[model samples]
Target chain A: MIKSLVSITGVALVCAALLAGVRYQTAPHIRANREAATWAVAFQLAGGPFPTNNVTLPLANLRIGGTRLDTVSTPGYGGSIEMLVALDRGSIGGVKVTRHEETPGLGDFIEGEWMNQFEQMQPMEVDTISGATITSLAIKRALQSHLRTALAETAPEGPPG
Target chain B: MTFRQAAIERNPAWVQLLGLCPLLAVSNSVVNALGLAFASTFVMAGSALIISLLRTLIPHDVRLPCFMMVIATFTTCAVMLLEAYTFDLYLSIALFVQIIVTNCMILGRLEAFAARQPPRAALADALGTSCGFAIALLVLGSVREIIGAGSLGAGLDSLFGPDAADWGIDFTDEGGGMLVALLPPGAFILAGLLLGLGRGIHEQRQARAHLRETEG
Candidate 1:
């Protein structure tokens, strides 16, 4: 009995040590990659070169050539959908679904060419796709909230003519 | 056993019918298939080596649970490594990777081969089994990706890197592609056809050998 206990404990300890070693070694690189990916996706949605160095919060206050870009997350059919919405003078410049977990074939229509419809429309007027209603609505709702926050932040400067 | 025998004649995927859940789930795309294959191979070989080395120390009653712990540890390591280096591919197949701990092929090898064999032989068996699994996944993934999407190597970029984004073939003009080929039924149908083809080839080889023996 004692032998069995000792052997099992030793093996478990060794396995734990190995796992910890790998996690420790890879944690830094993983964090760096994640940061780089966020910036890449943000830049893609922003459309062309932006002042990466000047941006305070890449996800919230992304400013590029008189346009403001903000990322928002909302629940989709499968999981949360992360969208990058570009705003220019109170109208949507462009909207891109940066990340989502919707069904591959069916719900993925939100990522299709049809998403161009969301561009140049007011957030409340954006229509959801037929089959992918939930995912589409998620993006719309996220945009609505982001627009509210963005407008309130710039509201102090008085209405731009 | 020889690598050839393990890979083909006594194949783990088709012949033994082991680890079919992952075999079917991730084989929808070549990149997903290759990612899972690499992760599984790493876990299988690592587990086999460690289990074989400690086989004598483990008590008979607790061996199964001990083997499982070892397999789970290796699987966790694979998941962490994949997440760190290949975040996109890791997200695509994270569920499958987590379930690798429960793969019967790994447990079966530990019980049937690893425990009784020396470390060197255990490593060879693990490699052979992994090769067989990888071959099966690649063949199924390629066939499904080509027929379903009307393109080959559609998502190679996810597995390789950004440079491979242009590596995918586009056949959008080929009559809109086959939706069924990318679904679950497609995996089942393709797997069945491949199994039949393998069996037919084996039978023909046996018949030729018999004919040569008679002529002699």
Candidate 2:
């Protein structure tokens, strides 16, 4: 009985030490990778004659050229869909699905040609993609709500128009 | 058994039917398949080594539980390392990653072979088994990805890095890839075909060997 207890404890302790060592080495790289991905997604939505030294705006928004880029998430058929919506002069410049959990073949069209409809239009004009109604609706609803909040927050700046 | 025999004649995936859940689920893409394969191999070999080292120290009554603890520890290490270094791939296979702890192949080997073998022999067996499993995953993943997307290596960038972004091949000029091949049923069909192929080859080899023996 005593030997069994001692052996179990020794093995558990060794395993814990090994895990701690690896966690220490990997934590920083993971953080940096996530940050880089977020930045890349934000810039890609902005669709620019590239901006030099794009300034960080308020409310998790980015200012690139004349466009303001922000990210939002909405519940979809499978899970949450995260999108980066770029606003140029109070109209939708472009919208990009940064991440999603819709059905891989059926509903993932939100990341494809279906999203092209949101380009250079008002958020209200966005339509649901055929056969992917739930995912498309999620993106549209999320974009409307986010646009409302963005507009309300920046109303004092004479609206991007 | 020799490594070649272990990998082919007694393959854990094809012949023994072990660890098929992740094999089918993540085999949609080569990168996902490779990621899971690497993790499984690491856990299998590490657990084999640790279990062999403690074979004598573990009491008979609690041996199974002890073996489980060792396998779980190695799996946790694999999970953390993947999450930290290959965050995208980790996210894609997170569900399958946790499932690896319960993969019968690891426990099966520990009970059937690792418990009785020396550390070196056990490690070699684990390596061979893992190689077999990896090969099966790669073959299934390639077939599925190519047919499903009309492309190969679509997500290599996630596994290798930015330099691999252009590695994907575009087979169709105007793309409308088959959607069914990316779904669950596709995995089932492809896996069954591969298993049948393995069995056919094995049977043919046996028949030829028997003929040679009878003539001799």
Candidate 3:
């Protein structure tokens, strides 16, 4: 009993220490990678380069080129999907799922060309992908509700650049 | 076991039917298969080597825990490295990689082979087993990608560098292919056919050997 306990304890301690070391070394790089991917999508949605090349995240409402970009999270097949929705002149300029826990082969269609169906279309007139009904409905519902409030605010005049 | 036997004759994924969950999940694309294969290779070899070296110190009663810790540690390390270096590939297959610790193939090898072998022998087994698993994944991935997506290596850029974006070959125009081949059920169908093919080959080889013996 003593030997088993000691062996497990020693093994656990060593593995934990090893993982800590690896985490310390890779944490910064992982953070940078995620930030870069998010920014890449953000820039793509906004239609061009930001005024400043050195801008970092926490962009505060994420407005670019008169388009309002919102990070919306809605319940998907497996869990909540975080999407970057670009609202441009009452139409969807672009849509990108920044994060999702949906099943890979089933619900991943949202991140592919299937999402192009929403591009330049009125938010409320979108149809969900056939196989990925739950995920698509979640994204569509979120966008419609979000648009209801957003369009009302910007209806008086076009969104400010 | 010899490397040849481990890799082919008694293949982990094919013969043992171990690690089928991740195999089917990530084998949808060639790039995804290669990414998982690379990570699995690193984790299997690393954990096997560590376990063999510490086998004597590990008590029989607690050997399972020790093996689990080693395998989990290597899996975490693989994930970190992939995230830091090949973040694109990591993003595409993050869930699969994180679950490598639960892959019975690794734990099975550690228990049945590594715990009783020398470090060098254990490393050889690890490499051979990894190769076997990689072969199964690559075969399933290639067939699925080609028939299902109408392309081969379509997303090679994610695994290889940006320069490899054009490495893929598209058989159909406008990216049209049999969509069912890329779906979850497609994995099972392709895997089953491939297993049958493998079994046929094995039986053929054995029959020929038996014929030679009988004639002799």
Candidate 4:
């Protein structure tokens, strides 16, 4: 009994040490990669790179021609679809699906060129994907609703025309 | 088990049908398949090594927990490496990679072979099994990518560096391929056909050997 306890403990300790070493070496690179990906989309949405060192997510006030970058989450076919939507001048400047649990191959269309339909559009008028109608409609609804609220709050003159 | 038997005859993906979840899910593209193959191979071999080295020390009753811990550690390592280096590719297949620890193939090898074998033999079995799985993944990935996307190595740049951006052959115009081939039903159909083909070849080889023996 004593030997078994000691052996398991030893294995656990060794495994933990090995993982800690790997994490220490790779953590910085992972962080940098994530930051780079997010910022690349941010720059693309703003139409140009702008300086903002400490911007938070889901509600980033990107000081670039009145662009409000916010994260939106809505129920998708498989699970929640979390997207980073940039609203510029009451229209979507750019949209990026940061996380989702939709069915692969079908619902994953949102991650590809299908998302481009939402760009530069306020009401998000686009046809739903053939097999992924629910996911597509969910994204359309979320973006349009968010845009309505955002426009209403900013303009203080009710919903947009 | 011999490398030949482990890698070809009693293969994990083909013969045992283990780890089919990631196999079918990530095999939609060659780059994704290779990425997963590399990660699975690393985790399997790494865990096998650690388990074999400590096999005698681990109590039989508590071996399962020990193996789980070891496998999880290696899987985590693979995840970190992929996220840091192949960020884009990793993002697409991140879910599959995270679940590598639960892959029955890895655990099966650990329990059936690694636990009892010496370090060298255990490592060999792990490598052989992983290679077999990789071959399955590559074949399925290639077929799916070709018929589904009309391209091979379509995302090479994501797995390799930027220099490999144009490495994939474009057999058709963009978005002109059969969409169903990239879907789950495609994976299932192709996998079933490939398995049947493998078994047919194996049976033919055995029959030929038996016929030669009788004639001699």
Name the best candidate (by lDDT): 4
Ranking, lDDT, top scorer first: 4, 3, 1, 2
Candidate 2's residue-wise lDDT over A76-116, tens digit each? 99998877778877767787776777886689788777677
What value does the lDDT take at residue A149 in candidate 4? 76
DockQ of each: 0.59, 0.42, 0.73, 0.73
The positional error of residue B81 in candidate 3, measured at the CA in angstroms, is: 1.6
Instruction: Please report how far candidate 3 places residue B102 from its true position, in Å.
Output: 1.8
lDDT of 3 by residue, B117-184 (tens): 99999999999999999999999999999999899998788888899999999998898688888999
Which candidate should be chosen as best, given DockQ against the real structure?
3
DockQ of 1: 0.59
Q: Candidate 4: give the TM-score of chain A.
A: 0.70
Model 2 bad stretches (over 4 Å)? A48-161, B153-157, B161-171, B175-177
* Native contacts recovered, each model: 0.77, 0.51, 0.95, 0.88
Per-residue alpha-carbon lDDT of candidate 4 for residues B99-178, written as tens digits (9 for 90 to 100): 99989999999999999999999999999999999999999999999999999998799988999999999898755588
Second chain TM-score, each model: 0.95, 0.96, 0.98, 0.97
- Candidate 1 deviant stretches above 4 angstroms: A1-5, A54-58, A71-85, A88-147, A157-161, B91-95, B150-179, B207-216
Error of 4 at A89 (Å): 5.0
Share of real contacts kept by model 3? Answer: 0.95
| Higher-ranked by DockQ: 2 or 3 | 3
